[model samples]
Target: RPSRPASRRDDALYRKADFPWYGLDAAYTGPRWLMQAAVAGDGAVEHGSLGHGEEPSVRTEGGADKER
Candidate 1:
């Protein structure tokens, strides 16, 4: 296996680019920031959601997402 990325930004970038493939077998749409909200400062927080397949439909709990 390749060596891990050495920097936080690089790792985050790597994950951002690579995360989608993590779902290739699960019929999932993401490891994406499914919900994000601004915090009090210049910072923000996000929550990610992964979808497992349920034939004929794609759904997310909390009604947070719908397929386009």
Candidate 2:
């Protein structure tokens, strides 16, 4: 079967990015931050939300959750 075309709603903005940290402080941290901001459910800290000013809550490795 042929693949269906993606709609505007299926854009990258609607996708999620994963961040894998190997160590406490790594060079890839920069990229991880970028990816998180790009597709993070809570949205970017600078942008303060993509469509809404309210951002979602994000869980941290410290067993705590924070809002973006």
Candidate 3:
């Protein structure tokens, strides 16, 4: 039997955008940058978020009010 193909990186699957991407606003400047993005089927930017400070660690919190 043949071996399975290697998986691609998460960033490799990200789509490119022509428009500028901003984090928060012009006044608030901190250690924030482009984390990831979500695009439509037509390759349009639907929505995304910016990462602040340090990289987040994965954790499971069993609560309705807890943030994902």
Best by lDDT: 3
- Model 1 ranges off by over 4 Å: 1-5, 18-68
TM-score of each: 0.22, 0.18, 0.43
- Model 3, 1-68: lDDT tens digits are 00122124323323355455555566654555445567789976666655665545763465467566
**Candidate 3 residue 38 C-alpha distance from true site, Å:** 2.2
Q: By lDDT, is 1 or 2 better?
A: 1
Go through the candidates in order and give each one's C-alpha lDDT. Answer: 0.34, 0.31, 0.49
Stretches of model 2 off by over 4 angstroms after superposition? 1-3, 13-16, 19-41, 44-68
TM-score of 2: 0.18
Model 1 pairs in collision: none
lDDT by residue for model 2 (1-68), tens: 00123244433332432333223243322222212223335652322122222233664566556778
Q: lDDT-based ranking, best first?
A: 3, 1, 2
lDDT value for model 2: 0.31
The per-residue C-alpha lDDT of model 1 at residue 2 equals 11
Per-prediction backbone clash count: 0, 0, 0
Q: In model 3, where do residues sit more than 4 Å from their true spots? A: 1-15, 24-33, 59-68
